[model samples]
Every structure is written in C-alpha cells, then in structure tokens.
Target: MNIQLKHGADRLLFGMKESDVKALYGEPDRKYKDEDKNVIYLYNDKKVRLTFYQDEEFRLGYIITANNACKVFDEKVIGEEWSAIMPKLEAKGIRAFEKENFDSVDNYFNEANWVIFQVEFGEVIRIELGATINARDEFDWKF
Candidate 1:
C-alpha cells in the first residue's frame, strides 16, 4: 500500500472518525485504552500503531510505523539508505535534516509538517507523523 504523509498522519488522516479507520484497516490486531481514555489500535503484524483521542468526538491523532512493507513517495523507506531517501523527500519540497542521538538518530523532514524518521545505522527503523499540537513538549507533556 502507498502511504501518504501529507495528511498529518500516515494512512490514517486527521479528523478521521473511528468507523472510517475500521473500514479502511479492518479490525485491529489488538485494541486498548490508555489511562487518559484515549483509544489505541495496534496492528502488530504490520508493525503499525494508531492512537486516537476523544473529546467531543473521536478522531485519529497519531500514527507510528516500524515496517517498511509499504511505499512512501514511491520509495521503500525502511531499511533504505538515508542517502537515497533524503533526495526523495527534498524533491517533494520537504526539507530534511538530522539530530544526533546517543543510540539512534532522528531525521526530521518538514519540521513544520511534523514528519520524523528514526534512523539506526543509516536505515530508517521507525516513522512518526502527527500534528504539532499532538506532539509531546520537551517536558514530556502532551498538549
């Protein structure tokens, strides 16, 4: 499947209702609620997890993916060389840069767009996409 990052989150877009997610992804491998009562759907087999928040209504808020089986921008991101992926993101007008970490490196593209790729040994291992509001602050607190 081709995953689009323009929708704030991958696969599941922002403002998508709970039912819309079920229709598109079918039943999740596992489902649970967090301490805050936010719903989380886990597709472990696909190495994907989706988190939704409910306030007035339920809507998709975050998407975390570790699998590279799907294509993004027509390129296989996971396990691909960062050198190869950087150009593709830039071609899409998404500026790419990296932050060094002790263990794994974080490559951020379009910071204003909130797209991040966690790299290890020059290969993408995880991708996080969401809105800035949904992201946790430096204090480890969510807004």
Candidate 2:
C-alpha cells in the first residue's frame, strides 16, 4: 500500500466514487454504515477499510489500511515502532503528534490528523488517511 497523505493511498485516491473503487478492487467483503454514520467498505482479505460520507458530494472520505507492506513517505510503516517511525516522521518534517491517555492504542498525527498511525503493542497496526478538500475548489473534481 502506498500512502499519499491527505491525497489518498495506493490506487484508491480520495473523492473516488464507489464504482471507481469497486472497479479497482472488485467487491468488498462487507459494506455497512459505521457508528459515525459514515459508509464503510471493508476488504478483510486485504486488511483495508474505505470510508465514505457526505460533505458536499457522497464520495470516498478516508482510507484505513493495515497491510504491513504499507509505505508512507517512502518508508514501510506498518508493524513499526514509535521509536523507529518517530525518526521517519521527523525526517519528513511531520513533527506534530499527540499521545493521549488511552491504553488501547497510541496515535501519531501528521498534518492536522490527516494521516494517522494507530499503534498497539508498540507497533503500528493501522494507518488511517483522509482527503483534504478545500471548499474553494469544491466545483473542481479530482477523481
């Protein structure tokens, strides 16, 4: 998996419609609405979850991938530790982070929480990324 930060990940870019994604990955293992009411399409075999919701248009909003092969900023991040990822994030100028009091997982935020590394057992388990939409460009579609 190749993460392009707020732009999207791999061949699945942000603002992609369901048909666009389905065309790429075929059918999903499961598709349902999440607790937040966002539509979630889960591909269990690929360990990826795609979220879609309505802001202006009902389209892809976020992508969460758990593939250990996932790469971001030219580095393999999944299954990596904070000590290791910290350097990579810092080296890439992703300096802002927040370690909350929760014990389940520690999240590393890069650029206004656009891309996050959800770490558990001291290793990254999932990478959640979202698209950055500038309302000024709402009329322009990038998909």
Candidate 3:
C-alpha cells in the first residue's frame, strides 16, 4: 500500500478510532500495548503494526510496516537501495530532514511531513508514518 505522508497508509487514516480499524481489518492476529500504553494491533499477513493512542483521544496515530511491498510516491521502497529511492523521493518534493546511523540501521526522517525510513545494509527495512501538525501547528485529525 502507498504511504500517504502525514495521513496514513493503506486504508488506515491517522485519526480513525479503534472500532473503525476493526471494521476495516477485523480482529488483529495479536494485540498488545506499548510502553506508552498505546494499543498495538498486528496483522501478520498484512505485514503491519498499527498504534492507536491510548489517551483520551484514543485514535489511530501511526503505522509501522516491514512489508516489502510498501510504496511511497508510487515506488516500491522496502528493498530498494538509497541510491535508487532518494532520487524519486526528491523528485516528489519530499526531502529528508535528518539521517542518522545507529550501527547498522540508518533512519531518515522528515519533520516537514511525517515519514521515517529505516534502512539496514543499504536497503529500506521498515517505514513509520504518522499524523502531522497542520500549517496552523495543530494536530491534523484526519477522520
């Protein structure tokens, strides 16, 4: 599925409720809470993890995917080397804000939007995308 920067990926939107997700995905294969108590729903077959805020908002907030079929800007990304992917992202006017290496893993994040690419051994291994603050500096609630 295509990563819709600052919005979501697949059919999951950033501000959707837990029930909304369930309606679309049915019961998760495994569900648990993260350190922040945010509920994590895993779809092993879909190769994705969805995190919904456990706070009062209680809405879908982000997606973490290791699916090799993930796409951004309409280009397959998970297995592509930086050399091949960077140019396409740039052409789409998506510029990375920072890139840091943690031993073997490297992360490229964009603050202007809301996408992070995690790479290891020169190929993207995962992607994390979330909601973003709007131009008014307010959290975007994409219901």
Candidate 4:
C-alpha cells in the first residue's frame, strides 16, 4: 500500500551491469535496438531503453528511458502459522474470504502472480507462493 523509501525511491535507478537488468525486473517481453546501438527493455505495459555515448573525456555517457517503475512481487514468507497469518494478511489490505470457498477466490491470485497473501474468512488459505501467473479462465473468475 504505502511504501515509503528513505533515499532512492527511483525504482529504475540501479547500479548493476546491463546484463542483470532483466533479472531485476521480470523477463522482457520485447527488445529494440536504436541506430546508435542502444538496447531497450520492453514489458507488456512499460518500456526502458538505454543509450551510451562518448563524452569529451572519453567517458561513457548513458541515457535511460522510463525512469519510474512499479515494483510488484509474488514471492513472500509468512512467519506466523495459519492462525497468526490470517489477521496479518488482512491488515495488509488483502481480501479475506471463507476458507470453505477457496475455489471461489482462486481466480483472484491465479490471474496475478504478484500475490502478497491470500486469506479466507479470517483464516489463512495460502502464502509464500511463487511468481507464476496462470492464464485467466473466465469460468474460474465466476464466484
């Protein structure tokens, strides 16, 4: 919800090699190269391109496109057991449903890999899942 960064709130401002960029973000959906020989990282809804040029001192000058990014994560660890984990997840703004109705709520997280937590009717249903966004099934979404 409210993530406050003390210093480097700029998500795109990274200090790693070019090769590691994709590892930071998810795999790039597409790529493009400019006439100047620069590489661009393209996502489904976002794009970031990098350009390199030589300055007067022969130092590398770089230009980065799409300086801002939204960080989404699906993997997480829940410290408490089911009893303790349920309330915690709800506090984080995750919708809680009836555990007996787990099937009804499956679509919520199945369509989105970045699932912080999933609770059911004041009970912990699932936690600590991986970043695996399954294909959307219209039937599954029906509740």
Per-model CA lDDT versus the true structure: 0.70, 0.80, 0.88, 0.33
Tell me model 3's lDDT, rounded to 2 decimals: 0.88
On lDDT, the candidate that comes out on top is 3
What value does the lDDT take at residue 46 in candidate 4?
41
Where is model 4 more than 4 Å wrong at Cα? 1-9, 47-143
Q: How close to the true structure is residue 52 of candidate 4, measured as C-alpha lDDT?
A: 21
Rank the models by TM-score, top first: 3, 2, 1, 4
Residue-by-residue lDDT tens digits, candidate 4, 82-125: 45544444565554443334453322232232333344444333
lDDT of 3 by residue, 8-103 (tens): 988999999989999999999999998999999999988999988887377898899998878997899998997789889989898755998899
Give one digit per residue, the lDDT tens place, for model 2 in 37-141.
Answer: 777899987789998875545588888899888998879988888789888877877888866535788877765537778888888888888777465944233
**What lDDT score goes with residue 33 in model 3?**
91
Per-candidate clash tally: 0, 0, 0, 2
Candidate number that wins on lDDT, 1 or 2 = 2
TM-score of each: 0.77, 0.87, 0.94, 0.28
Model 3 segments beyond 4 Å from truth? none
By lDDT, the better pick of 1 and 3 is 3
Clashes of 2: 0
Model 4 weakest 10-residue run by lDDT? 1-10
Model 4, position 122: C-alpha lDDT score: 43
